[model samples]
Target: MHEVLIVGGGTVGLSAAVFLAHHGVRSLVVEREPGPQVHPRATGVGSRTMEILREMGLADAVNAVAVDMKGISLGKVTVETLAGADFTTMSPSAQVYRDPDFTPARMRGTCPQNRLDGVLLGAARERGATVSYGTELVSFEQDDDGVTAVLAGAGGTRTVRARYLVAADGVRGAVRDALGIGLSGPGVLGPGINNVLFRADLRHVIGETRFAVCSVTTPEAPGTIVTIDGEKEWVFHTNADPAHARDVIRAAVGDPGLEVEIVSVLPWRVRAQIADRFSAGRVFLVGDAAHAVPPLGAFGMNTGVADAHNLAWKLAYVLRGEAGPALLSTYDEERRPVGALAMEQALLRLADPRLHWDNDPAMAAERARAGVVNAPVVQLGYRYGQAVQDLPSAEDVALDLDGSVGSRVPHMWVADGVSSLDLVESRFTVLAGAEDTAWASAGARLIDGWPYGPLLVRPDGFVAWRGTTPDDLPGVLSRLLHTA
Candidate 1:
C-alpha cells in the first residue's frame, strides 16, 4: 500500500509529492494527461510559495529560470495600445511586494505553469516520489483504516490501496462530485474569455516599459496582454472569438505589419467558488479541486501549494507515530479558511484591481467590512483560526510574524546568510531564548534573543505555541495534536 495516492499531476499534486518527500514520506501521483501542458498559465509565484520551495532546496532551480519582476508594478496598467503613448498605472502606490524584508527567501518569481510543473515533477522524483502519467483515478472508497482506489491507465485497470488519498483533479474533476461536495459563493463571475497564445516581436513595441499585465482598452481590440517571456511569446486574453485572434493581436500590438503566429487558444471561465468541505473520509482536496478563484491575484495555484504544504507535514507526523489521526482533521480546518479568504480577495480584485494597492485607512475599512483583504494579506498575513481559537487575537498582519500561534514565524537573519526560518525542519522544533537548563533538558534548541522566548514551531513552519514556560511544551503539543 502506498503512503499517499495523489489524483492529479498538476502544480498542486506535484507540490504535495515534493513536500511529502521532504519529510521522508512516499507518494504516488497519477495524472490523466500524458504530460504537462505547453502554455503559459498562472505566471505569478508569491514569496510564501517560494518559501516552501526553498524548504525543499528547489529555490535556486526555480530562480534560475524564473523572470525577476523586481521594480515592476504588479498592479495592472491600462493602455490604448502596446505602442501607444497613453499609459496609466491603475494602482500607483500599491507595491506591497516592494519591501525585501518581507521574507528572507525569494520575493516573487514569474514562471509559466508548464515550466513550474516540470521543475516540481523533477524534484518530486528526485526526492523519491512516483509519478505516473496517462493514468487516472477511476474510483475510490475509504474506511477507517485506509482508502482503496481503482486506477485506469494504458496498461489496464488496477486497484491500489493507500493510507490517504488527495484529490488535485481540478475544478471539473469527478472526485469532488463523486464525494458529493458542494461549493459556496458565486459560481461564475464573468463571461468566457479566450486566451490567445501567439508569437510576435514586441521588443520594439514594449521598449523599456515592461509590464506583467497590460490592459489594452482600445475599442477595436479590448483585451489583456500578458507577458510570457517579455519577448516574442505573449498571451492576449480577450472576449472576442478565436477566429479574430490575429486581428485582436494586431490591434493590441498597434503593429499591423508585424508577423504574428497563433500558437494555441484556450477558453476559460472566471469563477469564484470554494468547496464546502476540503476533505471527506480519507480523501482530501487540494488546489482547484478545493476552490476555484479568478486569476486576478494569482492566488489559485499558490493557495493550493500552501494547502499541500500544510497537509504534508501532518500526514508525515501521523505516519511516523508522533501525532494522532486527529491531526489530519486540522488540514481542512486550517486550509479551508485560507482558501476561502483567497477566493474572496481574488473576487474583490476581479471587481476592482485598485483594491490591491489601496491600503489607506478608508480603503482598509472598506476591505475589512467586505470581509476581504489585499494581496499581501491574503498571501501571508492570514491566521489559522482553528489553531489559535483560544488566543485573544490570533490574526497577524503582513510581515508581522510575531510568534503568534497559527501564524508563520518571523523571518530574520540568524547567521551570515541563514534565516531564522532555517531552524524549522520535518519535525516539531523548539527555538529557545536562552540556554536554560529546563529548556535544554526539554529538547529546546537555544538561540539568543529569540523574542518569542520558548517557541514551538510545527513541522510546516507555523507556530504551535509561544510561552515563557518550557514545561508546557508537551501539554501544548498534546492539545494541538489531540494525542492525549
Candidate 2:
C-alpha cells in the first residue's frame, strides 16, 4: 500500500504530493483530467504563496513567467452610467497607498492558471510522486489501518490501497461525498463571468499602467480589466440578468469596430463554503474539496497550498512513528479556521462597493489614506495558533496593526543570502534566537529514538537543536512539531 493517496491534481494535490515525496513518503495522485486544464481563474500569486513555492524549489521558475502588477485602480458606477469613484474609503487599498512596499520579490505576480498547473505538475513528477491522469475515483473505504480506493484509469477499473487518503478534488469531491461530509456555508452567490486569452493589440485601447484597472459600468455591473501576457483580458461581475450581461460588456468597450478575439468565457457562481470537518477515519479533505472562497483576495489557491504544507510533515511524522496519531488531529483545528477567516474577508471585500471606485477625488483620497493603514497582508499573514499551543507567550496575542495574526511568523530575507523560506524544506524546524547545545541534544535524542528528523531552530539563523537536548525537550518538541 502506498503511504498516501491524493485525489485531484490541481495546485493543492500536487503541492501535497511534492511535500510528501520530499519527506521520503510514497504517494499516489488520481486526476480526472488527462492533463491540467487552463481556467481563467486566480493568476495573482501573492508574496506568501511565493515563499511557499520557493521551498518547493520553484520560486525562480514561477517568477520568470509571472506578470508583475505594480498597483491597482478603483472606480464606481451607477445604473448604465459609469463614473469615477474613490478608493480612499477602502481600508485594504488605503494601506497600499501609504507604505508602498513594492520590492521585486515581495511584489505580486500574475501567472495564468494553466502555467501554474504546468509548473506544479513538473515539480510533483521530479519529487517521484505517482500521478495517474484521466483517472476517476469511484469510491474509497477506509479502516483503522488504511484505505482502499476503487478507481477507473487507462487500464480500466482497479483497486489500490493506501495508508491515508487526501481529497483535493475541486468543489465536487467524490471522496468527500462518499464519506458523507456535507459542505457547510453558502454554496453559491450569483454568477460572474471572465473572458481570457491572447489578443494582438490592447495597449491602444487602454492606458499603459502596471495596475489592475477597475471600471464600473453601472451600479449593477462591475468589471475589472487586466493585462496578461501583453493581452487585455476582462473579468466582469454583474448583478444584471445573465442574458444581457454580454451585451452590456460589448457596449462598455465603446468600439464595435475594435478587433478583439474571445478565447474563453468562464461563468461561475461565487461560493463561501467549508466542510463540516476535515477528516473522517483515515481519509482527509484539502483544497476546494474542503473549503471554497469567493475569488476576491486571491486566497483560495494559497490557502490550499498552506494546507499541503501543514499536513505533509504531520503525516510523515506519524508514519515514521516519531509522533502519535493524536498529532493528526491538529490539522483540522488549524486549517479550518484559516479557511473560515479567508472566506469572511473575501465576502467582505466583494460586498464593499467603495473598493471598486477610483474616480471620486474624496473617495480616492480616502482609499489612499486607508491603503497606508490596511493592506493585503490580512490574507497573507495568517498563522496556526492551534498547532503551536505550547508556545510560550512573550506578548498577548492580538491582530497585527494591519489586522493579521500577531504571532504569525514573519517572512524576512534569507540570512546567508539563501531564501528565508528555504529553512522549512522537508523537515520540522524549531527556531530559537541562537545556537543552544542543550536544545540540540534534546532534539537529537527525540529523533534518534523516534522516527523522523526533528530540528530545533531559532527565529533567527541559530540552530538551537540539531537533534538532541535534555531539558523538557519532549514538551517543547511536541508543541513545535504539531502541523497546521
Candidate 3:
C-alpha cells in the first residue's frame, strides 16, 4: 500500500507526489492519459507557487526549463486590428514577484502544462514516487482505516490500498461527481473559446513590445494572441472556427504576407466554481477538482499547486504517526477558503474592463481609485485561517513571522548561506532567541539568535505557536498540530 494515492497526473497531482516525497512519504500517481500532452495550456506559474517548489527541491529542475516571460515588454495594447490603429495599453501584470524586495528566493516562470508535468514527474520519480501513465482509477471505497481502489491500466485491472486519496481529476471531476459533491458560484463564466496553436515568424511584428497576450479588437477575428515561447509559437484564443485558424492568425498578427502553420486547436469553457467540500473522509480534492477559475491571470493552476502544498505536509505527518489523525481534518479547513477566495478574485480579474480593448472609462477610473489591484496580494500575501472550530488563539500570538500566527513565516537568511525557508521544510521547529530562552520541546529544534523570541514554525512554514519559555511549547503543539 502506498502512503498516498493521487488521481490524475496533471500539475496538481504531480505536485502532491513531489511534496509528499519531500517528507519521505511514498505516493502513487495514476494518470489516465498515456503520457503528458504537449499543450501550452497554463503558461503562468506565480511567485508563491515558485516558493513552494523551491522547498520541495524541485525549483532548480523546474526553473532550468521554465521560461520566464518577463522579458516580454509590451503590455496589453488595445488595437483595432493586428495591422490597424492602436488603442491605450492595458495594465501590465505585476513583476514585483521577481524583485528581491518581495521574495528572497523565487521568481515566476512561464512553462506549458505538459513541460511542467514532465518536470514534476521527473522530480517525483527521482524522489521514489511511482507515476503510472495510462492508469485509470475505476473505483475507490474508503473506510475508517484507508482507501481500497481498483485501477484499470494497460496490463489489466489491479487493486491497491492507500491511507489517503487525492482527487485531481480536473473540472468535470469524475471522483467529485461520483462522491456526490456539489459546487458553488457561477458554473460557466463566459462563452466557449477555441485555442489555436500555430507557428509564424511574428518576431518582426512584435518588435520591442513583446507581450504574453495581445488583444485584437477587429470584428474580422476578435481574439488574444498568446505567445508560447515568447516568440513565434502562439495560441490564438477566439470565437472563430478551427478551419479558419490560419486566417485568424494572419488577421490577428496583421501580416497577410507571413505564413502561419496551424498546430493544434483546443476548445474549452471558462468556469468560476468552488467545491462545496474539499474532502469526504479520506478522499480529498485538489486543483481543478476543488475549484475551477478562468484561465486568465493564471490563477487556476497556481491556486491548485498551493492546495497540494497545504495538504501534503499535514497528510505526511498524520500518516507517519508523528501527528494525530485530527491533523488531517485541517486540510479542508485551511484550503477550501483559499479556493473560494482565488475563484472570486479570478472572476473579478476576468471582468476587469482594462483587459478588454474597449472599456467604460468611468468604471475603469473608479476601480483604479479603489485600488482594486489584487494580483500580487491575493497571490502571495494571503495568511492561513483557523484550522478547527475550537483551535486556540490565546498564546498563538504573531511574532516576526508576518505578524500573524497562521500566516507563513517571513523569508530570512540562514547562517549556512541557505534561507530561513530552507530550514523549516523538514519538520516542525522552534527557533529561539539569541539571548537563550528555554524552549526545548520534543521534536522541536531550539536555535538561538533569532531576531524575535521563541516561535513554533510548522513544516509548511506557517507559525504554529510562539512563547518565551519551554513550558509553552508542548501545549501549543498539542493544540495546533494535535500531536499524539
Q: Pick the candidate with the highest lDDT.
A: 1
Deviation from native of the Cα of residue 385 in model 2, angstroms: 3.1
Residue-pair clashes, model 2? 41
lDDT tens readout by residue for model 3, 12-128: 999999998988889999999898777677877776787787887777777777656454444345566655643225444432224444444454446667777888888899999
lDDT of each: 0.81, 0.61, 0.74
Q: Which lDDT tens digits does candidate 1 get at residues 259-369?
A: 899999988998889999999988999999999989888899999999999999888888888889999898888899889888877887767676665556567666655
TM-score of each: 0.93, 0.77, 0.88
Model 2: weakest 10-residue lDDT segment is 95-104
In the predicted model 1, the residue pairs found to clash are none
> Where is model 1 more than 4 Å wrong at Cα?
72-75, 86-99, 357-371, 386-400, 435-437
**Higher-scoring candidate on lDDT, 1 or 3:** 1
Task: Report the C-alpha lDDT of model 2 over 1-484, residue by residue, as the tens digit.
Answer: 8999999998889889987876778799999988777654666565556656766668777867766543542212232322232334432232122212211144344676667777888878888898999998988888889999999988899999999999999887888888889877877887655443424354554444333434445433455554455345544444445455445455454444546555555566688999999888788889899899887666788888877877887788899987778888878987888787667667766776454333334663554443311224334444456222232321122233111222333333334444323553445454322334345533331122222233454221123343443565556666655422
TM-score of 1: 0.93
Off by over 4 Å in 2: 70-108, 192-200, 216-222, 232-250, 353-377, 386-406, 412-416, 419-421, 424-426, 434-470, 478-484
Ranking under lDDT, best-scoring first? 1, 3, 2
